[model samples]
Target chain A: MHIVICIKQVPDSAQIRVHPVTNTIMRQGVPTIINPYDLFALEEALRLRDAYGGEVTVLTMGPPMAEDALRKALGYGADRAVLLTDRYFAGSDTLATSFALSQAIAKVGETYGAPDIVFAGKQTIDGDTAQVGPGIAKRLDLLQLTYVAKIASIDLAAREIKVERRSEGGTQMLKSRLPCLITMLEGTNEIRRGSIEDALGAARSGVLKWSAADAGIEDLTRCGLRGSPTVVKRVFAPAARAEKAVQIDTAEKTLRDTADELMAAIFTRQPALEHELAFNSGA
Target chain B: MSTVNRETPRPAAGRAGIKKELPDHFKDYRHVWVFIELERGHVHSVSFELLGEGRKLADKLEVQLAGVVLGPPGEAIGNAIAEAFAYGADIVYIVEAPLLADYRNEPYTKAMTDLVATHKPEILLLGATTLGRDLAGSVATTLQTGLTADCTELDVDTDGSLAATRPTFGGSLLCTIYTLNYRPQMATVRPRVMPMPQRADKPVGRVIQHKLSITEDEIVTKVLGFLPDSQSATANLAYADVVVAGGLGLGAAENLQLVKNLARAIGAEYGCSRPLVQKGWVSADRQIGQTGKTIRPKLYIAAGISGAIQHRVGVEGADLIVAINADPNAPIFDFAHLGIVTDAIRFLPALTEAFTRRLSPHNRDKLAS
Candidate 1:
């Protein structure tokens, strides 16, 4: 019943702001968080570890400073933390990322047996790509159950897991084999605050840092930008629509008059809306 | 433009023109393709939406716009082709298969990538649906090409590069990417992001069918059964004409009722921010934010939502965006068409009563008379 949760350190979006003059992001002074979504995955993994007799290991790939994210994961009651960091891995896209993470998972397995379940957040708020978990599954050849809302049950003895997968409309009761990767959706569970002991242990505990060489990777090409097929040539803000919406003068008009005037204006533009309103009243 | 060639050399570059050896195969790939998503016996609107966008990229490169559709026997098959034509597709490639009855990954990816290999399309687009994201990755991996997920903007630069832009850092920053060396500039956009094209009256298009060489046993994953959503719960929030969305400022679950009341008064649908759903105040379906749902309503009443870029992207399409918040400095006012600096709790009820008086059936009849 061992669990592995993949987390990435990303710039805190709340503090992020676009420069008024340049319209580019002002990234200075913006601190990084453990990808807000990954918190949910880490929390779910911790809960699973608490319920079942197993250890939870947190994994992240970033610059050396990302060790802080791993330490924070350790602080949240995780048994161990692994940081897969290297300069070569800097420009890796999702494809390259999954490749590196998969190699790291294999490395971790060599040290501490293959995890029964792997956890990832539904999608990273930074990338919002939502493909890495599936990518890892494809690379590791693990059954992927994404956008999982809840873990209905897991029978380790039977080697079967039942989970509620979030679909287009509702939740689907998906049953998959063990050693599956589940991307936990937001709002499924609340992240638990670590106790004094947990924080103390994390403050002292060391995070195992592994680069491409240390991860038992035979091919360096598949581990970085060279292996990554996708490239981000440039980044620019979305162009605001040319025509802006006109704001009607409602300074003197009362709320009632405003609503009435708005309705009349809308009806003038869309004559069918008036008919639809007429129909809503069973006229 | 010469530098652009240096940047994106296609077909593994010329043998004499400095070809950086790629993995065995994937040396020659060209043209552009779009995946017209057909699910549950009907074509998703996003497919047409992608075609409208795909038409631009194809014209930019002076290439043909081909749609790859995988579906069962039905009018849906023709509808996809017809809709693709209306949306400006030059060719609609169909892969009729019983294995693709439901939106499963294995067979559809096989059909799409096979078509790409046989008749290579340099760029491929798919609607960012549950089905699309699932299928795109596998296909991209199999083809050994780069794939960008959840792109908000796609354009072909003067150098004939597919520049895909998407929000990064949680909609706080935008990053434009190029599938520089990869063939088939792959991208997926959520439904409603691209404007729907007008339906052409005639079938101004061509069709080329592909052989789907896949069997049920070949794919390990199986859709054992299908469960349809109930009518009451199936709320298509994306295209709702009148939308009332609440945010963290709503305070609590009980306050969300005010938003619902206002929505009811205006004959609108109600939803909330991701925070509200996180707080367990609403279902995930009702969450309206960057990662939740992108909506384009005629009128949008946002109460308590301090419109972050993440939320703004989802609601930017609203014709009339009226934001109500307690904080006058809330970002929602920056983009909102109309704004009122007032407490959402108090203002929501007042707006509800105001809409009620104006939109009441009795008042409508009286005004008509």
Candidate 2:
């Protein structure tokens, strides 16, 4: 079996902050990490490879610096890494992204091997759109299973795979044919640290690089901004409220006293809450 | 007015510019359509919320608002149509077949795309739930149109384009996206992000039924079974009247008990910020943020949460917000109605004791006074 996992390098969103005056994201000095969600997908792919005796290839589309993300996946026991980078791919939205990726995935099949399963994170934190995985599945004609909490079973001979998918109010046990795209949900499993041997092997292995042309993207317009149907008209910070939080004085007061004072302030601002809480608690 | 940031690269000028006029074929695309998500014989509340929002856009554009329902042929479909009209839909478009009973991407995508082809809609809205996201992505890709996901705001621009506003760059910034030339502009809003519209007793109007072209034998993916989450395990945080949530500042996994204790003391639902879910200290369902549940409780008590924009957007709709954090400059204080600077690990227990004493049956009468 051959499994391909898509990964992305994203800025650590937790560390991202907006400029107080400029009201713009301060991208400078912010560190980039492998998208936290993708790690779950990568780990799941590795586990599948280990169980089914297959090769796992990690793929990413980004700037040259994204090679680091591919290498990191390599260290995590993926057999090969592919980087699809091109100048034309900049400013691409989710639709254009899936187009480029689906084309690249087809090329990967020709060069590496036909993959039985493709893995991706449920969504990237930076975008949080959760569209590209389904988009790729639709473009490639692959069965898409998203928010997969667990792979219940996979029958390699029958090309059947069953997964526990997270839905709105319940878990759907879905069984689909192989050659499917699976987007793993976060917190399903913890990512394992790379062994020293694995790290050394990853550091030594050369990453395979492919441009849009090399990836067999026949339509140049569809690869980037030109093909992107959605245009971002403006980006701005959320407006701040007129009044800042009223500070409840805690200095020189006992913890209980401070708590009482805070509760009093809350009740004063929203008297209905106190009554409601009293009713609920008495019940 | 805000200046456009350099990091947000605009579409290039000239041939690829967004200023290009809508193609003549798409000029006839008229009404606004909201995909009424029906599963297991019930309509998700988010569908009604989208209708409420779509009604606004439709009113602005002076066009009709239609509800699109694709489900099994049964009384559920009839009930959904009636509810759609009550929730402000002027027209109802439905495709009923056993193939669409359970959401299989192939059949639903085919039905939705076929409907769009037959009756063009300029703007399409859907709830950003799991089912909606799965269907919207495939439908949009198949149609070769634009789709924005998890939009916090939906409006019609001056030029009649759908301006879908959503958090980008991990909720650090908000970007307004427009599908300039796409015939059926698509977007999905998360549940509880938009206010639910008032439902009135209105007779169903102009029902248009479409045929599902696919059969069960043609569908590859099969739903073997479904396991509903136990009532106790599910967090009803979105509709809770009072919510208490913790953050990374709780320090240890065991520290979460303090948060729950306080919530219990006040008979409130408990949750945590995204970091707690990421760290596996809490389940994803209990996460309160843009990427998680967008809650609109009456009273929200955030303990030790720094109130990142992601978390802020989720709870900002609360009637009153009270933030407790050790850092004096925490962003939660900016919007929290009341702020208390102290260690959450220590403060949480004290607050719980205070509430427990105040709300105990004997003291309840005194509190009521």
Candidate 3:
């Protein structure tokens, strides 16, 4: 079995800040980490390879610096890493990104072997669209299983798999054929630490880098900004409300007394809500 | 790589990229349609919310607003269509089939995509629920169109393009996106982001029936069973009347107990910010944020949360927001209606005790009556 995991390097969103005056991202000193969600997919792929006796390859598309994320995946026990980077791929939206990636995956299959499965994070924190995985599945015509919580079983010989897919209001136990694309749910499992041997091996095994042409993308119009259908017209912070919170001072009041004051304030503002809460408290 | 000529097909250079003329095949695409989502014989409220939003867009575009309903052939489908009309749909498109009863992607995608191919609509809206997100991604990909998910705002620009605004870069900022060249621009908005429209006593609209082209044998995936979430962990935080959520300010996972105690005392749902879930202080289901859940409670009590833009967007719809944190400068205080600067670890227990006293059996019985 060959499992290909797609990963991305994104600025740590927790530390990302928008300039208050300029309305631009303050990215000068922000650290870049492997998108936290992608780690979940990478770990799941590693576990599958461990059980099924197959190779795991980590793939990413970004600037040359994104190769660091691929190397990190290599240290996590993936057998190979591939980076698809080029000047033409900048300003790509989810649609163009998936087009570049699907073609690269096809190239990877030809150079190595066709993968039985492709794994992607549910979504990137930066993009937060959750479209690329399904987009890839559609372009490749593969069965797409998203928000997957667990892999129940796999019949390698029959090329079948079963999974618990998270759905609205319930969990769906779904069975599908192999060669499918999966977007894994976060926190399903903790990522493991790399061993000394694994780190050393990762240092020795450099990533397989590919430009757009190398990835078999010939349509320049379809490679980046030109192919992206969605365009960002403007970006700005949400306007701040004029009224700030009415501060409940705790300096003089006792803790319990403070709570009482807060409750009184709430009732003063929304007397109807107090009754509404009582009517539905049973819920 | 082939170098392409830009002049022959250039339409106009807009803000993000070059906008192109709508292909001759797509020039006649008209109307704005909202997919009325039905799950387990019930219509999801988000679908109605989208209809309300779609009405605005339809009016802006000077086109008819329609509802697309796909479900099993039953009274539930009829009821959904009726509600759609009451909620402001000018027309209704129905696709009835047993295969669409439970929403397998293969058949539903084919049905919706086929409908789009046959009757072209300029804009398609859906709820960003589990089913909608799953279905929208596949359908958009199949149609080779653009889809914006979890949009907070939708409008028609001067050029008649759909301008979908959503929080991006982890909710640090809002960006407006346009599907400049794609027909039937698709977008999904989370529940409660748009206000529910007033339901009028209107008759059913013109219903157009479509067909599903696939059968069960053709679908590679099958739903073996569905297990509803247990009552204890239901964590219906999205629509709760009162919500008490903890954050990293609690300091330790054990301190989450204080949050729960307060929630129980007030008969409120409890949740935490995304970091707490990542820290395993709480499960992902109980996490509150853009990625976890978008909640619109009547009252929200946020303890130890700093009110990142991501968390703010989720809780902004609360009728009243009360933020408790040690830092008075926390962003939560900016939007919260009330603020208390105190350690949540210590304040929570005291608040729980206060509520316990205020809601004694005698007072509770009086209030109940």
Which predicted model would earn the best lDDT?
Answer: 2
Q: Scoring only the second chain, what is candidate 2's TM-score?
A: 0.94
Error of 3 at B332 (Å): 1.5
What would the per-residue lDDT of candidate 1 be over residues B309-348, giving only the tens digit for each residue?
7788788877778777778767677788766666688667
User: What fnat does each of the candidate structures reach?
Assistant: 0.30, 0.71, 0.62
Candidate 2 residue pairs that clash = none
Give a tens-digit lDDT track for model 3, residues A1-283. 9999999888788788777687677878988899899999999999999999989989999888888888889998999999999888877877788889999999998988998999999888777778889889989888999999999999999999999998888899999999999999987888999988999999999899999999999997877767777777676778778999999989877988999998888878888776665544542
Order of models, best TM-score first: 2, 3, 1
Model 1 alpha-carbon drift over 4 Å, by segment = A28-31, A47-52, A152-159, A192-200, A221-227, A238-283, B1-28, B72-83, B201-206, B248-254, B278-280, B325-334, B341-343, B367-369
Highest TM-score scorer: 2
Model 1: residue B293 alpha-carbon error in angstroms: 1.3
- Tens-place lDDT per residue, model 1, A44-153, is 89888889888998898888888988888888899999998887776677887888898899888778989899999877767777778877887787777787878888
The CAPRI class of candidate 3 is medium
| lDDT over C-alpha atoms for residue B302 of model 2 | 97
Please report, as a residue range, the 10-residue window in candidate 2 chain B with the lowest summed lDDT. Answer: B1-10
User: If both were scored by lDDT, which would come out higher, candidate 1 or candidate 3?
Assistant: 3
